[model samples]
Target: MHDAISYLLFLVGTFLAAGVVKGVTGMGLPTVAMGLLGTVMPPASAAAILVIPSFVTNVWQLFYGPSVAQLIRRFWPMMLGIILGTVGGAALLVRVDPVWSGCWLGVALMAYAGYALIAPAFSVPAALERRLSPLVGLITGVVTGATGVFVMPAVPYLGSLNMSREELVQALGLSFTTSTIALAAGLFAHGAFQVSQLGTSAMAIVPALIGMWAGQYVRMRISPKRFRQCFLFFLIALGLELASRPLL
Candidate 1:
């Protein structure tokens, strides 16, 4: 009963954060949700529960936000990299230790969060940005497949690009959607898809959507600096949680 109560609390808090992240930044459901969920559940289960909601939220972003087609066309090479990397990552996940994988993910995310904290300006030259973007996609795709922590690489890349804030948000949204599809397929292939879990995930989507709407509202009131700060703080907390879980 205690464990059950903890699980319920985690689900509620995770979705609430998910919504806020999505609403404010127009992306980050998986990052925020999976991060929080990592504290209470195994990384695999955390990824599982987040999968459906992340997909739904990103789908919503793709439709509601600016010119997704143009963005996709501009980044097809990155998309292909994601596809290839995700397949390879999924294969590795089946063969390795998840705790070790989680540790690496936590370290990477902590580093990314640190970078976000210190960077005063987020601008990359178009030529270098274009060349680096696919590498980010490839790393993110593999990480997404293995640990469900796929937001790191692309977040900085998107931030560095010359797109408007809305466009950056949409790009993250689309990337997550692609990852969710790949993860779902990989999980099913690995026999990790549980009917009961799927049903639970479906039910959780309601609160997740609500939280996203709320987050969008919150985003307008906060400055970008504050948003980045809060985001970094959250990442640190999540990273510590991930690193500590195995020992605890």
Candidate 2:
């Protein structure tokens, strides 16, 4: 009984911390949550618990920006690719070993963190946006489906578009929303999402929202640049830890 209570408390605290990161940076809920929870549970289970909260939070972000219609119109192809790729990739999730999945996730996290730290200045050419968007979406979807972490080629692809900060945030929201829904569908298809898990996922929303609120308050006070550096460093460490688990 005590162990159960402790686990529940850990989950609440995890979501709260993840929420604060998302509230401040407009992302990181799943990455942070999965990183921490994967230590306690299977990777697939961690991903399962993230479904509802990730969707709700990204939905909030999706509507908070201007020109939703325009954004949708521009990114529909990528969205479609995301759905297809996720469905395909998620089919593998149920069959893969948990340790392997954790290693894959860890590698992905490290790669993502490394890329972010390098901070390349390249942008997608206007001419190539039409050609490259679907590919990016497909890749991102596959990664998300396989690892339950969605922020690879997609985030970089979106950043390459050179949208204004507000537009970029909204675009991320849209991408994340699409990823969350597709992830949920994949999990359902694999029979990984049980009713009991759904209840836990739903309850997590409260703490996530609370953390978001607190994070928003902190965002007003801190330097985003500095915060991001710290966040990425943490991810790098977490990624290393996750990657080493298979060997351990």
Candidate 3:
């Protein structure tokens, strides 16, 4: 009984912290949640619990933008590609040994951290966006499926689209929402995610929201850029530890 309570506490704390990171950094909820939870549970279970909180938080981010219709019309191919890639890889995610999946997830975290830290400057020509977006989505989908971390080629690709700051945030929301929904669908289809688990997932939102609120408040007082740098560095350390867990 105590063990169950401890587990629940730890789970709540993980989401809460992840939420705070998102509020401050404008991202990292899934990556942080998955990284921490992967320490205590298999990647599949971590991902299953991640579905609801991720979807709910990203929804508000998705709808508040002025160019939803325009973004959707432009990125539909990428969205479809994410769904297809997730469906294709769901079986692998569930069937593989947890050790390898954890390693992949860790690698993904490191890659994302590296890319985000560098914040490299480049852009896809408008002429190439139509062709490159789907490819980027497909690769992002594979990464998302294998590790359940949704940032990658997708975020960088989106960054390269030459959007304004506000559009970029909303665009990120759209991308994350699509990934979350695809992930849930893939899990449901594979029977890795069950109805019974959803209650706890729903409950998790309370802490996540609270943490996000706290983070937003903190954001008003702190340097978000510095916070994000620290956060990314933390992800690198966490990723290294996770990747090395099996070897150790």
Candidate 4:
């Protein structure tokens, strides 16, 4: 963050771009925001600024297409694992170098982009869900805690669950919402999250929402697959940029 005005402009632009990605693809807000912001700021500061908007948006998405109770009943272990893993791994941010954090963050972004672009065909047996979900959640949470991006193995794991599209979407909402809460808690535990970040983080909501609205409109009229491919490719580029920072 440089001058106040420039910071706000950049914040708004970054989040607006993130919102559009999420609107079109049903995910990617944190991934895109963290990737871009991590380039210029430490992971902890970026994570702090990200907490509110990510929570607000994902919470909204969480309630829309399913029974929350059923989701919790089925996914509680995994959710619990996320909380535990995030709590356990949060110290990485306080202890590790920011350059290492950014490099890992970029790798996480690239991992997700490659997976989503390829859209691998795989499925978990229903019987195995009970055994595997928590493991996936824990890995996701550790990544979330370490890098401030939480999609990786979790999103791909979710897709592998063979859930119906509606359930899948809402489940992702729940997963993201849970990750956001845990990330906030992790930041709070270190006192890295502060009230000073709140105003700008909250102000970011308007642009994010506006961009989402616009993206929804674009989603209807265009080839979403094509748009998504472009977005994924862009993420790969961003990933490369961030990953190169330590070297640069």
The estimated TM-scores of all candidates read: 0.87, 0.98, 0.98, 0.97
Q: Is candidate 1 or 2 superior in TM-score?
A: 2
lDDT score for residue 247 of model 1: 84
Candidate ranking under TM-score, highest first, comes to 3, 2, 4, 1
Model 4: ten consecutive residues of lowest lDDT? 87-96
Candidate 3 versus truth, CA RMSD in Å, comes to 0.9
Regions of candidate 3 where Cα sits further than 4 Å from its true position? none
Across residues 83-143, which tens digit of lDDT does each residue of candidate 1 receive?
Answer: 6677667655554566766775577667767877776676778878678878878887887
> On residues 87-158, what C-alpha lDDT tens digit does candidate 4 reach at each position?
767789757899988898888889889988888799899999999989989998898898899897889888
TM-score of candidate 1 against the unseen true structure: 0.87
- Provide the global lDDT of candidate 4 against the true structure: 0.88
| Candidate lDDT (C-alpha), each | 0.75, 0.90, 0.90, 0.88
> lDDT per residue, candidate 2, 84-154, as tens digits?
88878886666788888888888888988899999889888999999998998999999999999989889
lDDT by residue for model 3 (38-74), tens = 9989898999999999999998788877989988898
Candidate 1 lDDT (Cα, 0 to 1): 0.75
132, model 2: CA deviation in Å?
0.6
lDDT of 2 at 6: 100
Q: How far is candidate 4 from the true structure (C-alpha RMSD, Å)?
A: 1.3
Pairs that collide in candidate 4 are: none
Angstrom error of the Cα, residue 10, model 4: value is: 0.5
